[model samples]
Target: MNKDEQLKAAINQKLIETGERERLKELLRAKLIECGWKDQLKAHCKEDFKHKNTLYMDKIMWTIMQFK
Candidate 1:
């Protein structure tokens, strides 16, 4: 299998063994959102070397992640 499929299979196997598939899925979704937000922020900040804006974006992203 490909790397993505292999990772999915491994995750599924672990969930089956632990019986926490639903909870794990939720956590994964939140993590994905956080990662996406981080990527977007980095892309935006690349053109503007503004540390304050980057810090603000990080804080906002973290707050949203917490609520998720």
Candidate 2:
């Protein structure tokens, strides 16, 4: 993995290890928005950066991993 992938992986691992579903959800939302998931997010929800969940995160992260 490259730096970005590594970083995302680290974050994902940490989030998984936290053992708190709400905390994980909140952080996943914030991180996804922060990391440019907005456009796709808008398409997914008909709004921009409104909310996020682990449901879409792996897909987004996979897309991210495909770049560069």
Candidate 3:
């Protein structure tokens, strides 16, 4: 897979392995909020968390903004 795909897979793996799923989810929620993607992230997560594709757009957008 491509770099983006790889990264998403990694995040998915981490989220799965994380014992505190709710905490990690909360952390991610906060980060997304701090990164200005809270609304989109929340709406996307409300649908399903396993569907990484749903959050890819917002994740990528947040990443770009965070590093810029």
Candidate 4:
């Protein structure tokens, strides 16, 4: 309607988006921990003599073997 009303609406929309982003960050952190992401990263790390198994990597081991 008015310039001031439009500005308020825009500010409110931005605040809602920011809140959603923060909630998403927290949810993603929880999912990463639940899925063993930290452990999976360590397992696939480029270190020697660390042949740890991971869910996705196990499926692609044939291709990985070509690199070794």
TM-score of 4: 0.39
Q: After TM-score superposition, what is the CA distance of residue 52 in candidate 3 from its true location, in Å?
A: 27
Q: Is candidate 3 or candidate 4 better by lDDT?
A: 3
List the candidate 4 regions with Cα displacement exceeding 4 Å.
1-18, 46-68
State which candidate, 2 or 4, has the greater TM-score: 4
lDDT string for model 3 (21-40, tens) is: 67877898789788777666
Write down the worst ten-residue block by lDDT for model 3.
44-53
Off by over 4 Å in 1: 22-68
What's the candidate order when arranged by decreasing TM-score?
Answer: 4, 2, 1, 3
Predicted candidate 4, C-alpha RMSD: 11.9
- Top-scoring candidate (lDDT): 1
Q: Which regions in candidate 3 have their CA more than 4 angstroms from the true location?
A: 1-19, 39-68
- Any residue pairs clashing in model 4, and if so which? none
lDDT of 2 by residue, 7-60 (tens): 988878876787665687789889888888865645654332245444476666
In model 1, how large is the Cα lDDT of residue 35?
82
Clashing pairs in 2: none
Which prediction has the highest TM-score against the true structure? 4
29 in model 1: Cα distance from truth in Å?
A: 16
Greater-TM-score candidate between 1 and 3: 1
List model 1 lDDT by residue over 1-68, tens digit each: 99999999998999889979988778887997778965665555553444454456666566445542
TM for candidate 3 is: 0.30
